[model samples]
Target: MDSTATGMRTHEIFIDGVRQVFHVAGTGPVCVAHSGGPGIAWEYLRVPSLEQRLTMVYLEPVGTGNSGRLDDPRDYRLDAYARFLHGVVEHLGAEKVFLLGHSHGGFVAQRYALDHPDRVAGLILFATSPVTGEEFWNSAMAEVARFPERHPGRPEAAGMPDAFQEALAAGTDEDYTTALRRILPLYFADYWAHEELAPMRAGLLAWIDPMRGEEPAPFDVRDALASIAIPTLAITGAHDFICGPRWSRMLHEGIPGSRLIVLPGSGHMCHLEEPEAFTLAVADFTRASVPGAR
Candidate 1:
């Protein structure tokens, strides 16, 4: 399977009996992108400009899109996602590929690189953190609390907290989807000002079970981040309430010699909020990290 096999298309491959679905677009170096939410549809992570610089593999992720779901919903953890990602990379026949993960997807990327360094040419930890425990939750809520201060009298500001709580408490797919739309604007630096993104908000889909699954331990890989020797880039939107600069900086500090880029004008969804700047950073990093890739 050479690079040409990646020509704008959608491919499906079975991994451990589970069908994994992914879409291929653009040309150049192969870069596999995993969207956030553990449950969010992968479509939102697509960046057409970046596709111009690299062959983008947008994974639908098992249990999310056309892919198969696990019999036990609790099995939807980082390790499972990483395994499916590895299968996609192997099926592509790319000896080495750049892995880009956004938000929760970033967590999957980090776990993959740390577990399989030889298979990865570089890493892009976009709008994600290395840990997710009490500290992480507290810091995120703190940021949410400040939303009203930034927006002043905006009516949406009043419901932001409740919206976030609803997101966490969402018991069904429909409940989660509703909660997501209500807080979708909060993911952008200035979503209301960008009416063009309304359709994205309207079409969002997610699963409530994955997020509510039981974890043997709180997700924390800070101590192991230093072991990742491949060229790495950690980027996020400055205004990102959850995985903002503080979290990205920890990624930078923990991953030795990694590059950090904070898009000041964006929020959690930096790629959508600032595609040009996001593309430039990712494009340059991939070109430099994987020599002769283009």
Candidate 2:
């Protein structure tokens, strides 16, 4: 493992023949977490404050970031992803670790907790949905429609879904990369425009290669949420049109003892759009769940 300038130690670990890279930093109880997209890397979700207080394990899901591709696209289901997370925690020898997931990653974290509640110390879900229903997709499309007028060269934002589907059907590496770069801004209008993290974007684009030839596992967690008894935190951004406050509200209501925090003016990528508020919310919840973590 090698250390980064930000005081984090990074390592490459393998699970089920798929290579995964993770960055571990700070002290205290472990916080095993991953990013969204079902394929997005951890780079976009990096938060310095969370790392300062907890041993944050930022994971790169198989076929994403520095992680190696899985030979079988069938290995990318939610159940498999949950097992992969469990393996990572076991690999680190952490008896109980706080779990955090953003966007789609929240779905993965929640499922893992349900399958192995004993392994988790706490749960943190950000801008996630309970189920992938028609209402959710319609709401997401509405949000995408509002961006074209404001974003230059994206006069056809409303047609993103069809365009995306077409690209997936016959896209080369460069084509997929272009599609991702185009769609990413819709997730976080502010960060994509302002954050100077060019490498992160490039890495995300590169990660798309493994993401292809795989379908996103259908998201369903009603039964799973009933099994989760750990202290949980659900965060949403008021402006997040993709997975709006309604989604987080459903999660908070369904999960027993879960607290909900909705940040104002923030969108899908709430952590990046409003880092201070996001960190404070997560930090406060972490302190409450873990003994002496404050």
Candidate 3:
């Protein structure tokens, strides 16, 4: 497969009789990237820094991106998605991969590593948590309150917790875009500074999810994390509304020998707001995790 600086090849594979699509960019060892959203497109997790250094297999996820959607919505459950992730590695004929998962995708990645510890060379987790449920919504409420009272969407931001689901239920591009705009302030440490443009761009590319993580009720993976034998790096923003530095700390502590990095004055969108720092953190982790590094 010929890949230029900007060229990529999209490939399709069948898992449980359903066709799933993923993109391949660069060469050398594989680092499979699972985008957040659970249903959002893969573009959000696109890290240009890691693309060429390590061939990244950009997973579109089971029901998002160029991948095929599932008929039985229950299949969207986290465990099922984790199973799909395992299948992807086999489909690619790789023995092991350095995995990157953000937000919901982080949940799936952890589940995969928990179930198949030997298959992962190392893990790079961003803006994710061991437990996700009502607490996620509650913490989000507190975080949004920090925003200025005069912010454009302050009044409507009360419903930001439900905005993603509302947009999902509505299933209209316009509604999705509006919900994306309304809830934009909640995701940034300093919303007015970045303004609506960033979240709006993300929302336009994002999609819907049939099963929210809150479903089947909240569950925590901290107990199982102790058994993971891979070097893991957890990255989070100090101001991340949903999964703040504390959550990242918990992730680091639960996984034996894991490292955590926090980006100051950033929120959920730090990958966008602090791209250079975020990218370099992952790059450093990858290099340092190697057998020898000075």
- Report lDDT (CA) for all predictions: 0.88, 0.76, 0.77
The alpha-carbon deviation from the true structure for residue 104 of candidate 2, after best TM-score superposition, in angstroms, is: 1.8
- Comparison by TM-score, 1 against 3, better one: 1
Q: What is the total number of backbone clashes in candidate 1?
A: 0
lDDT of 2 by residue, 1-294 (tens): 777678988888788777878888887778988787765557778787788888899888777767777787666667777877887898889889999988878878887888898999999988888888667777786666666654556454655556655545544556666666656656664444555545656666534534432336446677667667899999988878688889899888888888999888677878877888988888888889877644
* True-structure lDDT of candidate 3: 0.77
lDDT of 1 by residue, 3-90 (tens): 3653558888899899898888888888999988878888888898888888999999888878899988778888898999999999
Give the per-residue lDDT digits (tens) of candidate 3, residues 94-177. Answer: 888889888888998898898888899889888989887677667766665545453555565456556645654656545655
Q: Lowest summed-lDDT stretch of 10 residues in model 2?
A: 206-215
Query: How many residue pairs clash (N, CA or C atoms closer than 3 angstroms) in each of the candidate models, in the order given?
Result: 0, 0, 0
The lDDT ranking, best first, is: 1, 3, 2
